[model samples]
Target: MLKKNNSTPLYNQLVDVLIEHIKTNLDIDEKMLSEREICLKYDVSRTTVRAALNELEEMGYIFKRHGKGTFVSGLWKEMQNLSEAYSFTEQMKQLGKIPHSQVLSLEYIVANQDLAKNVGIQEGEHVYKMKRLRSADGMPMMYETTFIPAYLFPDLTISKLESMPLYELYPQVYNQDIKYADEEFYASVLQAKESEELGLPAGSACLRIRRTTYSQENKIIEYTLSVARGDQFVYKIRHSKK
Candidate 1:
C-alpha cells in the first residue's frame, strides 16, 4: 500500500516497492505484473506506473520489449571504474558471481596491415586469434576476441585460456609482466552474430571496447576487442580537484 500523503513522491515509492518485489519474488527474465495490474493493485494512475517503470529501466533493474511487458534483469548491474585493471573473473568474484569463459575458436593467422598497426607488430607476423564468450552465473556478459603474437607465447593454447585469466598466465607461463594497458570504449549496437552469441536481441545497445596491453619492456603483448552488454555494465569515473 502506498501513502498518498507521504513526503515521498508516489512514483518513487512505487519504484521502491517494485524493487523489493523484484529482489525477493522474481527470477531472472520473469515477466513483471502488467501496467494495468499494477495500477489497479496499487491504486495508482497509469502515468505514475509508467514513471516508476521508466526509472527502473534506466537503473538496470528491468528491461522492456515491444508487444511484451517488463521483465526482471536477473543479474545486478556491474560497475567498472576506468582507472582500474582487473580480469573479468576477478571482478565477478568480488561481486560474488561465479564467472566462466567459453572458448569459441582459436586460430593461427598472419597479421594484416591494420592488425599489425593496432598490435604494434610487424606485418605478416604470426598471431594467435582467440574468441571467447565470458559469462557470470550462467548469463552471457561479454564476447571477446583477442590477438597475441604467437612468437612471444609459443606454448599458449586454448585449453589454458579457458581455465584461467590470460593476465595470470602471462606471468606464470611466459614470464612476462603486464606493465600497463590502453583502452577505448565506444557505444554501439550489437550485430546479428554478436547478439546471437550473447543471447541478446539484435540491435541491442552494447559497449565496444578495444584494449592494447603492454609488457614490462613496453612491447605490445595483446590486442583485444570486446562487446559488453550495456544494460549489465556501468562505468564509473571519479574526478579529483587539481
Candidate 2:
C-alpha cells in the first residue's frame, strides 16, 4: 500500500513501486493494470497513478499503443537517448553486436529547394545521397538515407561507405570534423517498399527520425532520414526544469 510520503512526490513513489514489480517479473503478460486497479491496489488517486504511468511511458519502460493499454517494452527494444547523435554502427557496437550496412542506393542529385535548405546548400547544388539498410548481428534494424553536400566531400564514393562508418570517413577521407546534430522524431507506419526492404511486417509502426548535422562553423553538412523498427528501438529524453 502507498503511504503518502512528503520526502518524495506521491507519483514518484508509485513509479518506484511499480518498477520493482516489473523488475521482479510480476504480472508482465497482464502487461498493464487499469487506472482503477492501480488506485484500488495502491491506495492512490487516479491522478497519481496516471502520473506514474506517464513517467514510465516517457522513460521508455512501457509504451501505450493507441486504443491499446500500456505494455512493458520487451528485451528486444534497444534503449537510446533521443538527444544524442549516433551512427548505426556505433549503436550496434555499444550493444556488443556486429554491425553491417548494405548499400541500397548511392548517387548524386541536384538539390531541390527543400533539400538545399536542410543541408545549407543552394538550390541546384549537387548533393550525394546514400541509402543503406543497417543490420545488427545479421538482423535488419534500420533503414537510413543521408544527403551530403558534394562540394564538402568531393572524393567520396560508395566503396568508402561499404568499408567504414560515416564518422570514420568524415575525418579520414573528407578532412571534416563531425559534430553534434539536431534531430526530430515521430511515429509512422512503414511503407510497402520499406517493409519489404527491412523485412518488417507490412504497415508496421516505426520510428522516423530526421537530423541535420553541423560542423564547428555551424555549417550544416549532412541531413539524414532514419526509420527504425518499432519493436526493436525505444528512445528516451530527460527533462529538468530550469
Most accurate candidate by lDDT: 1
- Candidate 2: C-alpha lDDT: 0.82
Give TM per candidate.
0.65, 0.65
lDDT value, candidate 1, whole model: 0.88
Q: Write the per-residue lDDT of candidate 2 for residues 1-242, one digit (tens) a residue.
A: 66575788989989888887776774434567777898999888899899998898766677666676778864213445343546777767767899999988999899999998989989999999999898999999999999999998996788887877888888777777876878899999999999998998889999999988888777887899999999888766656353
For residues 152-228, could you state the per-residue lDDT of candidate 1 as single tens digits? 89977788886678889899888889999888998999999999999999999999999999999999999999999
TM-score of 2: 0.65
Q: Weakest 10 consecutive residues, lDDT, candidate 2? A: 74-83
Clash number by candidate, in order: 0, 0
Q: What is the lDDT of residue 47 in candidate 2?
A: 92
lDDT of each: 0.88, 0.82
